[model samples]
Target: MLTFEEKLTIIESFPELTRNDISLGRVNFHFEESVKDKKVVVYRLHPNGNGFVYAGEIENSDYVTDSKGMVNIRDFTEKELRDVIQQSIASLSESETVTETWINNEGQTLKLIETSGVWNIYAGDDLDATHATYHAAADYLYQEGFRLL
Candidate 1:
């Protein structure tokens, strides 16, 4: 729970940032370096008085950490920081699907996927069979094409 002034100061420390880029929250943004580009950096603060740095397109995933697993924002280089952001954006752009595989007694592989926050049978696109939980979604798959597999 850093004070607003303290958080503002932290963001301002980056040569790329100005007073206008940050807002109080679990995360903040840095646009100084990317003023002429589409890329922007993000910082997620920790309760331990340090913060994690992310750049480029953002996603809901692990925070960028150093080689030694330090999440402190000051521990990363410009390239390292940008790499983390690029990796996350690439992974997210590659697929919105989260899938788990199961094998049947007959050795058939069944893949269950959740995409766009909805769960459905991946092979069938059974939109009407959507469910709120992985268990329910997989159950639907199991009942449909995987019952005897």
Candidate 2:
């Protein structure tokens, strides 16, 4: 079984992850990207020399991997570690969502909906338009001085 120091050393080896951003607990090492978003990736190490990497809050297999097959986190080399972290970063970047109800000076409520990589804009009960990216949607809203709620 990997000791606490060994686990910490492996985790800190990631250049993107600052050692200060890691919280080493008795059984898990919680490492987070220093982004504005609140989501984090956790490595839950078991006492049996095995572990799993959980990407987000939801308990699913999408970004979850165990110590088996192509994914054994316990046996990952430095290159594999970089690949995993890069994968997680890419996933997190694409998962960014913009959901807010903004009110304009004219008391108009503009709804911003982001789903499946598409941005939908609605003015009241009618769908005003759709944007291909969150930036485009936000830019349209900003043109009208909408205050997010």
Best by lDDT: 2
**TM value for model 2:** 0.34
All-Cα superposition RMSD per candidate: 15.4, 13.4
Which TM-score value belongs to model 1? Answer: 0.27
Cα lDDT tens digits for candidate 2, 44-97: 454444554443432223434443212446665544444454444434443535
- lDDT per model, in order? 0.47, 0.54
TM-score of each: 0.27, 0.34
Which regions in candidate 2 have their CA more than 4 angstroms from the true location?
1-4, 15-38, 55-72, 94-149
Off by over 4 Å in 1: 1-94, 124-129, 142-149
Q: Which consecutive 10 residues in model 2 have the weakest lDDT in total?
A: 54-63
lDDT, model 1, position 98 = 47
